[model samples]
Target: MALATVGGCGSAEPSQQTETDDSAVVLPIIPAGTKADSILVDKSDRTLILYKGDEEIARYGNIRFGDTPEGHKRFEGDERTPEGRYTINGRNPGSRYHLSLRISYPNAADRAYAEARGKSPGGDIFIHGQPNGREGAPLASDWTDGCIALSNAEIQQIWETVPDGTEIYILP
Candidate 1:
């Protein structure tokens, strides 16, 4: 049997006494709440605005969209972000990107359309941070699988402010 050593400087040795470390680090927490009336995604400006009953509360810009930013997403693998009124259903902290807020895509109409076309409805759409490669890149282009993209810090703020079931509308 072969053993690996730390720093690659010596042979590894197994300890006769089994020692287990039990320590945990606690992080400060933020409460969940919906303080906005609706969230608007302006495809033309590539910005997201949070409103409270017609009054603007906060705005997040430099958002990225799908590869093809044409009409609303009509089918699977269209690479087009959906544009319509929907609700934020849930949040995912273990997203491929950073944290994310799940958008209720493929509504009833979307499902029916995909079913009529005999195709599967694409899923896993979200408003998330940049991917690992593009994390440090400046927001210059619209390139995504089919979801809205934000900066890592912006996403963390959104995750804290926007609770599940918040209404959102994506416009063309």
Candidate 2:
């Protein structure tokens, strides 16, 4: 219900605008012509937001998640999306899913948590499009093994707008 609400936090701040000169405009956090410098996933709202500096550039709503999409993922097959910060580590254009953007899951804390419980912290988590067949793999709120699922067209736009190494903060 809160799809319009967006919060911004980043490691670096954009340069402040000044009356010095228009030519002194500082470069954006994203690359030239890119739309977003980073992304934020709000699991509770089932929404993913793209940000360029402190501004919310885009919002993708009605997202799908794991079968058991609450809490931090404890094992490889927990069917829960992980919470915390991650990066867009890789991209697969020809993925079984229409297209995929890999998110670095099982970070040190995640691994240590699973290790303490004697479980395998899952890997290969992604923000991906609907599958190539079957009329949408993640067609419901709880459908994936833990990855974020968006529509095919949505993923294509994300693929073009978001670059690898973009920080993606997934919130619980």
Task: Give all candidates' CA lDDT scores.
Answer: 0.68, 0.71
Identify the runs in model 2 with alpha carbons over 4 angstroms from their true place: 1-32, 136-138
Q: Name the 10 consecutive residues with the lowest summed lDDT in model 1.
A: 17-26
Name the lDDT of candidate 2: 0.71
Tens digits of per-residue lDDT for model 2, 28-104: 23354666788999999988899989988778887888888889877887788888998988776545565677788
lDDT of 1 at 142: 78
TM-score of model 2 relative to the true fold? 0.77
* Span of ten consecutive residues with least summed lDDT in model 2: 1-10
Judged by lDDT, which candidate is best?
A: 2
Alpha carbon RMSD to native, model 1: 13.3
Candidate 1: what lDDT? Answer: 0.68
Question: Which number leads on TM-score?
Answer: 2
